[model samples]
Target: MSRSIEYGNLMHDAMRGLIRKVLQDVADHGLPGAHHFFITFDTGHPDAELADWLSDRYPDEMTVVVQHWYDNLEVTDDGFSITLNFGDAPEPLYIPYDAIKTFVDPSVEFGLRFETQDSDAEDDEAEDPAAPAHLPAVKPKGKKLKPDETKSTSDKEDEAGVKDAEIVSLDSFRK
Candidate 1:
């Protein structure tokens, strides 16, 4: 079998690393200026943990805003845990990096989208009992965010002048 480079996975890893680094900085030092994050994730991910109500409300996916108020931000190699307020009710969540679908910081008009597939450990075990199961393989997709995907703006001028986020893809540099 010929070995080939997995550019998709590589790009995804790099993006996730960037998220990790950003979160780590925030965890160490508070969010700077008007900087905040809008993180959307797959609530159904095996490693994802959240309140039952949140799961029931957003069975498939959920978006949490990390601005104005948030707490208990703990970042790990595999995932991060945070507490966010929902209608005055505090909810704690643990989201794995593989579970993240989109991460946007509208303060800087930056964003990232990841397409991922969970690996079946059972299938891997069947093929090689001694082999360790692999984590999800993530594919990166750089796209402009839809209007609804962003935080709502009350200013009509702001809405009308909304800027499309720049797509950052590695494909251009690959060749």
Candidate 2:
């Protein structure tokens, strides 16, 4: 007897659909009751762009929080666009759908993961296991710190050092 598992692409498409639905919900009802998103994606992905200045500053990844004080939130077929305050400057960003690496809502424990499609296979034949695991890429100048950095000392103390809830992986959904 022989047995085999089929690694169909259904799971990948479904995960993408799920994320789209989540975003649609937010767009329709305006982030119902404490539900905000932490979206991380590859800034260099084919269809994404930050301000020229932002891209130069954060070449690898960038993450953004969709919560209070955001404006012009629009979703497009290719991706989405919104204006966010960077310190005193309100900058607009356009991120493509394919570039998204991770999408998580800490309030509900829901998350999605995506594969990074390589544009040039010959340039690199393998991935680096020793490098830090990829979370969503985040901008260095943003309000939130990189996932590795902790919040301010006073904020840490106020929360009694309780760890924040996060979705660590989407591998379980894959077949």
Candidate 3:
């Protein structure tokens, strides 16, 4: 029996850790400069908590912007909870890190997307630990990102030979 490294899952965990670290910094010092986020998550995830109306509207997935106005930002090992204004009606939400499908900081044209696995396939993998996991073709949804429209002071610094913004997909790492 040959054992193979699950690079996909490993990368996913590392990315999630990165998200956790970034959110922790924002919670401690507030969003620096023009830094902001557009986090999209699976509202249907078992651990995700949000208003019934919000779930109804978004159904499978939802994106929330963390900028300008927000409150009660509490980050834990498992997830974070926040209160956001909805038409002057503030709503509290708890989003587990595992439920997050996408996290984007348009201010920098940076984004991370997580491909969801089918429950049946996961079960099969659980039963046969050696089975190779398949990477699904995940199409990212939400507002289209225009790097030009979002060019910031940092982006302008790219003229000095800094790298341009890029959206990273884990699938690209798959073998």
Q: Count the backbone clashes (under 3 Å) in each candidate.
A: 0, 4, 0
List TM-scores for all candidates, in order.
0.67, 0.62, 0.67
Q: Report clash pairs, candidate 1.
A: none
Residue 52 displacement in candidate 2 (angstroms)? 1.0
Instruction: Tell how far residue 107 is off in model 1, in angstroms.
Output: 0.7
Prediction RMSDs, each to the true structure: 11.1, 10.0, 11.8
Where does candidate 1 stray beyond 4 Å?
A: 117-175
In angstroms, the error of model 3 at 8 is 0.4
Residues 2-117, model 1: lDDT tens digits: 99887657877888898999999999998999998868788899999998866765677766778788899999989899998765567799999989877777676577778553
Each prediction's Cα lDDT score?
0.67, 0.59, 0.68
After superposing all C-alphas onto the true structure, candidate 3 shows an RMSD in angstroms of: 11.8
Summed over model 2, clashes come to 4
- lDDT ranking, best first: 3, 1, 2
- Tens-place lDDT per residue, model 3, 1-175, is 9998886678778888989999999989999999888787888999999988667646677667788899999999899999986655678999999998777776665677777556466654442222233322333323234433221111111343532222333344444
Residue 116's lDDT within candidate 3 is: 58
